[model samples]
Target chain A: MRTARKPLTAAGLLWGVVILTAVLACSILAGLSTGGGEGGLRELLFPAAGDGDGTRQILLQVRLPRVLLAALIGGALTVAGAVFQALLRNPLADPFVLGVSGGASIGSVLAVLAGIGGTGAGMAFGLDGRMLFAFLGALGALILIEKIATVDGSMSVYTLLLTGAIFNAFSGALIYFLQSIASLEQLHDIVFSLMGHVPSTGFGTVAVLAIGILAAVLYLFLQARDYNAMTLGEEGATQLGVDVERVKRRTFVLGSLLTGLAVSVAGLVGFIGLVVPHMLRLVLGPDHRMLIPCSFLGGASFLVLADLLARTVILPGELPVGVITALVGGPFFLYLLRTRRTGHEFR
Target chain B: MRPALILLAILSAACSNNLQEQKPDPVSPKDGLRLVVVSPSAAEMLAELGMLERIVGIGDFVSRPPGLNRLPRVGPYNAPNIEKVLDLRADILVTVRSEAARASNARLRDLGVEVLELDTSHWEGTRQALRTLGDRLDLGESAGEILASLDEAMTTIRQRAEGSPSPKVLFVVGRDPLYVAGPGSHIDAMIQTAGGTNIAADSDSPYQLVSLETMLQRLPEVIIDTSDNGPDALRGRLPGPWDTWDFLPAVRENRVFWIDPDLLVIPGIRLPAMTERMGRLIHPEIFGDPVEADFEPSPEPGPTETTIEDSP
Candidate 1:
């Protein structure tokens, strides 16, 4: 409805992408420039006269990978949230609203309970058992929710939403049961994993997560026009020569893939998914074509900066990035809701 | 710290089994005046004072002083069941100082129970706690003897550690989020007395969740990791996870140790023994190499008679 009301021009879309990309670049620069340690962009720009391996290691080995991971997770979660909102035709829809994050959390909690964490439990290409199990949990939850929601040969939006809500509640209860039995040290790991902090990972893991998230985002981007058409209603989309059911199924799968990749690596970094898409939609309108790409870049910038604040706000001790995101995003979103004109396009 | 609070809430909530039991009429104290010791460290102190038979109930986390096993568990240390404590007819309830359980302890006191909140988290607090508990229980002579032995043992340890190099040490309490022992903690005091500079001495709190990058930058020479609690978690002088950070001096020199947290975390009469163990781990040349038992999870306190004199 928003796209139909306001025509999106090619030039306007280009300008939006360029501006968001510039913002993302700035955010990444800031993220790479500062950290909890001495190694930073200064070391990279002007090498000391003496040995600088430690500084380089801090920059490259610690901060660089963390920045990249945050960017990727942010982008993936935002894109997934935007797509889910379009498919569900609900402004409140988020990547985690469909129980995928809860599934990832259960897997993560179970892994910690079994003592399968730390950088030492390396399984493949810097992927530990915890991350692997989280991804599998997300995938399993997707399959289970899909099966429960599908009726005959079709999936109903209302049924899908309800199934996801119930599944998430169940997952939460199960995780609590698991936590009850966990040792104090294991309990610490479980709580941190759920609270969501971007860990300093190897480049191999970042590269792998990047490829997976980008491919899913690309697939969803291909269906942007279909999403725009569906905003009119499912029947209207079908009347406009769109394969409504096929597009819906594909969007569900691709969006869920993005959410899974993010939750598996970074735990449950909240608010970015729920807040960024709406913020971008208010600025760029609900044209999925522009909204998808801009949301990715804007969300990437948002989280990179939030993570920077999370690490630096208390000097040597770092807060969970999720805390920063929720603290900033929740109030901003509430303010936007309170001040914005009623029945706005994004709302 | 926030996570620890969440964990405390979870543990408190999980101790719901006792809540389901019938709340029988609150029984008045019997002639014997039984004691319910909710703090594991305090229970260990009571056992050391030869008052093990006096404890009628224990908090959930208390595992030491095996004689108390038959006693009914009230609940976790932070959220003991008041009904259960009353049912056991405990005239005196001894618990550790906790901000979270302040209201519960207050309510217990209102209900006519003599609640003794002890601070056994540091050496001085433990000494004071022994004195207070001894005065209350009329075992002041035994408490004095225990304190004397502890001071004598600690003085010997400090004398042995006088000239030894103070290697930079990292006392890891939890690994995934990198929780460390910082200033004001018993572990921090032990690290200092045993001739090692705590890497987290500059941290703002006693126990802090710190950045891994900052920890690496500090370059600790000796790492005492009591973080892993898995049944098959690494033990002894081995770099299980620290090996990944090959650049760390502790990893390079093979000085990364995986120990049981219970051995050093609980502060009580074992401060001297725990400090001696720390001395062995920190300066083996003078104190002798840590024996196999040093790395194991000995939640049970050693024999009371020889606790001060025993050495690896």
Candidate 2:
């Protein structure tokens, strides 16, 4: 039993970190390799060769920023997913599992209908309407779900999850209603926003996104010990000097914030939140301290690679990043479920 | 050049070998040449040729001279009702070109209904459509006359634009998700003809979603909102969120204008008129004051002008 547990310990966590860093680096190189192949990824590494051509502009301006945004969003979502699973103690817990995606979708659809398809619906005080509205929608969903789920000043994880599920269903129906009334142009925007993509952003936007995601993720990381105690059950966590209720509220809000930012920038990319943390937990033990950062790196790598596949698989016309996530993650998730049930692994 | 010659060679050989499927109908002057046009601009084109009297069935989006509303709507531009068309005893049908949307054109053709699907979606297509419809309907001489008059108007508009201050313009096509008439679009051509540069002319598509950041950065001098919900609905929704971007010159100067899609959206032989109107909208000083032309642009009334409040 002791030998069997070796990989799920500190040593394994260290190796996992190293492995994830490598994967992220490789994924960035691999992503950069696909588009604007004037001199390839190596030339990009060498500034001299990568400059003075359209390929250079395409690589640095378009491809690099896209990959960076994908990585940031993916990492943020994975960290949030890890925290949520630890909080809810549900195997199926993901960012969207709590109505975050539904709220963002509503906001995005509203933007489409208002004639701000690819652009921000409006801008006020430097906050874009599309991003601001989506974040507000996410926060709104959180409040509504929490209000419905909480009873006697105590929150039930099951009720919280259920309320989220119902809200998401309600949002889906409402989106269908909106789509039914929309013009063909608006309808196209609605479909694409809901379908979700890792859209290209300016370097300035990418920098802001990366910094914001990093802040949120680092905040989540501060609560890793609490999340670790969380895996021992809420009572167990409380017994270990953790403020269980405060931790829950903070993590829920923080996780939803991460989800909102991700969705606003990249649309509804799925699976990274659900699958990345679980995979990390299996290899690095249920230690949130290690799992959180690993999840970020692994998730970043996973999304960068997935986004790479999305753009290249179809060539000029690309599949939505969400489609790629669902396609690649769906079967792997099923396999995890099937094997975990059969093999009794990583409880 | 070589490909054209080969195409010509193939066409001559094919035509000489009697491989043509299209046959003219046996409608005499007494029958008045029954026609069913499944597009608004096509209906407008026929109206330009003085053939509006022959149109028996119109499409859903064909809003004009208040009488066509009484004529049976075949369907949306693409999926027209063949049953109703046959019931109306229409000898020929004209529609737009979008591959899958109008795929039923093949079935309509197979059913012995002469389906003339034209690329009447852009300026070039509109020009060609005029000549083709004229030749097809034996009104080629009339088509020539209309083309000449339109050309004259275009030349005047071009000369008006020449050396004039061409302000940066943004043409909004849809609002909810911020789509614009980009490069290769009829709207783009109109903007170019009207002494304004389309800021979105660099986009790869004819119509595409543009980022608001790009718009603010581009800082358009004039913004034209062409998104038509309905006449009444649009009037209520006229001052859309465009004012929020007060940093934009268009918003700062209140140069933003809402032209009904009826006058602008439908690309056809009305290119000259549409281009001139766009000129007036974008470069009022260069093109002179804007004339509120006949809003009900139909040459002849169909029967009832039911405003198409389409949802489904």
Candidate 3:
């Protein structure tokens, strides 16, 4: 049976890109313009004194790197979510749904407690002990989760989600135990490491992160067609000459890489993975090709705006961007759940 | 013109007279003032002023001045029991200014109890708070006497500490995540006043999470651990963590001393005593050894339950 094509044609894709770019541009310009006290966002962005002034230096040197990091993390997370949902054939699957974030956090938190990465000051450029440990943790979790949930080379989605959820709980409790024994100074580092904020790093560090995320995301985008085929059920995709196992494995590893990078670089800003892709799916339809790129752009816009709110809403003190995303995403998730029918399965 | 000049002279004399009258009285009378004190340190300050009897309601943490534990408990320092506070007919409720007490402070005011928030987070603030609390209780002259002595003691310490090599000191508040009293902290000020440099003095925060490696590299000559597992509390035991880093000067020379949290941790009226004790720890040659009050006597205790500070 030939179904109808959705509205997301080339022209629609162009329009979406244009609008997202506009949103991003507007957000970047306005990020430092809110809150009217001393060191107001406006003064920081456009210092009345010359560009070499401290305010401008802070805006460019400190805030800009973090802002860019947030956008990159958001895009990476959403793209990973889209890939996971397609490969697992589960709409509920998000980048963090498989407990990858939990694993990454444990490694980083332990490193933070051990005085790795040079205190709370964020000194990692590439493959620092914290990031390396986090990568190892994420890789470890991926392998373990895959091993436990697979039977006869056929992975059960139900077991996969359940294993991921339980692993997350176990990791969380482990972090708490570690936290209890850490020094009071180490306690703050542990809590903040898990609390999830975009730490301000230099351009060299940002470029390294940008390249890693971009490479992983582009690799996933290349597998979009295989994802589209897998959406036609495992047996159906196999009959259509697609290697279902290979696709699943590749998606799993690539998605895990994206998630590991997100957590290790910026801590644990969750809900972007769940919220951004789900929203994009509704608006852009299930076609993997357009959805992948769109999720990246849309997610970038969403997080930049959310981070702007996180930084400005409290004035001087910042609410965690994770809190902002969850506040917005949790209710939206509930609305989606209530509106959708149960037990039908997406395929 | 003569009349105008005479009127202007009279006006100037009257203004001068008004200014003199407005000058604060050296001693204010405490006329049976009813009070409810929420902060333990604030209660200690009042007790120093001999106004502890006036505190009809006291916070849960106020376990000082040897007595006054018998007063009606008004709950924790942050959230005082509104019913108990009002029930005691307290004219004023004095508390430390804190984020934890924001809602409680407002709620007490709503219940018709007068509230005064005093900032006693630092040594400077402690003196001002005591004076303010004294003024609140109408006992300014008594607080003034205590302030004068505190000022004199600090001045003496500062003078003697001058021209001497001030060794860097690390004041550890906890372990695992390693909380330290950083720059702008009350403990940092005490370290400076006691003729030592805080190793974390340049850090932006008052109390901050720090790296153990950084602390080791800084090589503090003196280490003050305020963790509860001290020799007094732990049957003549040393904290297990400090021994791991033998390379540290503090650990090597055995300058790491454990002190009572109540005396040092809480910034209060007891700063003079705390300062003197810290001085002895940092510069024993100049200021002499610290006194340790034995809380528990061991059955066959070696060397009479004395603290390391008191050891000759």
lDDT of 3 at B80: 76
Indicate which candidate wins on TM-score: 1
Residue B42 displacement (Å), model 2:
3.7
Which stretches of candidate 3 lie above 4 Å from their native place?
A1-4, A7-12, A32-53, A113-115, A118-127, A183-185, A341-347, B1-312
TM-score: which is higher, 1 or 3? 1
Q: Candidates 1 and 3: which is better by lDDT? A: 1
Candidate 3 lDDT by residue in tens digits, B61-115: 5555435566788875556778888889987787765455668777877776677
User: By TM-score, is 1 or 2 better?
Assistant: 1
Stretches > 4 Å off in candidate 1: A1-15, A45-53, A96-100, A111-122, A132-174, A183-185, A336-347, B1-31, B298-301, B304-312
CAPRI verdict (incorrect, acceptable, medium, high) for model 3: incorrect
| TM-score of decoy 1 | 0.85
Scanning candidate 1 chain B in windows of ten residues, the lowest lDDT window is B16-25
CA shift of B263, model 2, Å: 12
Winner of 1 and 2 under lDDT: 1
* Residue A4 displacement in candidate 3 (angstroms): 4.3
i-RMSD values for every candidate model: 4.7, 13.5, 22.7
Q: Candidate 2 at residue B138, lDDT?
A: 80
